[model samples]
Target: MSEGVVARLRQRLRHQADLGEVLAGGWTGLGPSELAVRPVYLEGSGTVPLGELFDLRGEPAGRIRFEGDLARADRLAAGLAEGEVIVEGSVGAQAGLGMAGGTLRIQGSAGPLAGAAGPAARRGMTGGELIIRGSAGAETGARMRRGLLAIGGQAEAYAGHAMIAGTILIFGDAGPDVGLWSKRGSVVALGAIEIPATYRYACTYRPAHLGLTLTRLRARYGLPVKKRHFAGRYHRYSGDLADLGKGEILEWTAE
Candidate 1:
């Protein structure tokens, strides 16, 4: 894919911005001028055109990159249906809330609920890929229905709470409730994790599918995938006996 627009922040934002409408449908066909007209909602302020905050350039390629600090920007790429969105720095809460299709890669950390549902919705992401290169705060993939949520660094508490389906890959330490109430999803942890009491220890075996997934993560994100993880054994624990209990947590081991 060709490189698309790069929206560099013009100034340090004093208030949080709701960039939910910045990448509306058909964004791939819009040039810099058209794209700059998109709306941005500022907290404690009012609405403003995207041009006021970001300097936009480049052709209408099917991808976009945001440069500079965006730690107070929320709902970015929310409900994204197509194209690729990349954030060079950390983002505020709900970074990719309820995205249906496409790719969202955050080069830096992310705040809470990166791929979780919105406030009014009960279900979270239905499809697509969410890649967080840095640490993620709590409930990173809450109530996810489908797609891949990968955290290259630490995942805070309740990492994959109530996921209906899909996969979560955590390369660093996982906090509490890795698979709290997931129904049929998979939580793959390559770092330290505390198994939940509700989960039943399943088995110790290497799943052949991991080679492909980990390889993709390594190649696509350069996430420091080690040699041992390619063919290593993982301890499986199935749980959330509190719910349907079909989900599983795969903990990688040195043995």
Candidate 2:
């Protein structure tokens, strides 16, 4: 494998920029010079070459790193079907919209709809891993079909709204209306959360899958997982009785 590509911010962004197209599968094979010319939609400015905003370096190797404050950058890794993407700082909305494969790791917080479906799309994050080491905004995994979404900090309301099938793990406080209209998905909350009224209480049990999943998060992602988490019991709630009623919310409880 070749050394991966690196794109460092050249200057402070005055406007929100859309970087969705910069890291698609085809662009991963291009050299730095060629990749630099990729289009980035800048607010008010219309469009500009990525090279004008970032200093591109390194070689293509199916991995890419973005270094700098990108809090105003949206869609940093949308539709990523392959390769790995690492963002060293915060990002704007739609960080992993419609991603089908690969991994998108964000070192800081993300805006609303971080791993949700696009405006025109029917599904969100069919496959892939979205790891947010910080808090996330509202509707973090809305309409998701399949994949793993891990949030290390607080999540706003409707964190898993309308989820079809997938897994969402929130390590901090989850906001209101979690798992509102989920069909068949799992929302695991390690912190305080209010179960939606549409869900019904299920028996408490130590799910075998929870232990394995927490182990992976600790070993691979370095998430803070204590022994209590692995051995704790979870309160399972089945809902959204308004929809398929197969979705569940797993709230961690001290045994």
Candidate 3:
């Protein structure tokens, strides 16, 4: 696929606008015409329509660029199964809820449960990558089954609650209870972090995969990826003994 569609936001939203179903599959087989015709809920009750929210144009090859501030836009990439979606600014809650596959990038901050499952849902972020260039609200990657999530800015409390399997990288300070109930996921902390008592210190060493992951985040998203973050020593802790105990927390150490 080629560069898909570009949707430029027209105005600040007074109600929720769901961009979930639109980019669900990452424009796999869809074209510009189909994409423009995709549905999106609008503010003030009844669905206003996606065309009303942004100026949609270009081909649909499974890649999309969203322009303008989407801070008020909720579910920007919910249930995505394929393609790549980029947001120029912040986004509202449940940004990538129940996302099965694909790549979703938010250039700015995000609200609560950024890549978590929806209400009554069993899993979150079943697959794919969700990148947050700025801060993320509470429970950023809760209940994720698989995929990668990188937060360039601070992450709020309970950032990776009950994650099944995947990786979450936080370049900035992480709040308390960052990975309380995670089952089997890796949380790499480049900034300050306090590991839960349930987690035991394993060792302080350089994890090769982390370097590759952080490097990608830096080069691709323009994150503040210093040399230290990639080559630095990290304090590895394994925990969530309450669950599978396969989860890990890598806290970067100054030494």
- Clash totals, every prediction: 0, 0, 4
Span of ten consecutive residues with least summed lDDT in model 3: 25-34
lDDT of 1 by residue, 86-119 (tens): 9999999888888888899999999999999888
Between candidates 2 and 3, the one scoring higher on lDDT is 2
| Predicted model with the maximum lDDT | 2
Poorest lDDT segment (10 consecutive residues) of candidate 1:
22-31
Task: Give the C-alpha miss distance for residue 104 in model 1, angstroms.
Answer: 0.6
Q: Global lDDT of each model?
A: 0.90, 0.91, 0.85
Per-model C-alpha RMSD: 1.1, 1.2, 1.8
Clashing pairs in 3: 25-82, 26-62, 26-82, 26-83
lDDT of 3 by residue, 1-255 (tens): 456788888777777777666766546676656677777776566565677778877876678888988888888889988878899889988998988888889988999998898889988898888999899999989999898999989999999988888899998999999888888899989889989888889999999998788778777777788988766799999978888899999999879
> Between 1 and 3, whose TM-score is larger?
1
Q: Estimate each model's TM-score.
A: 0.97, 0.97, 0.93
Per-residue lDDT over 125-144 for candidate 2, one digit per residue giving the tens place of the 0 to 100 score:
89999999999999999999
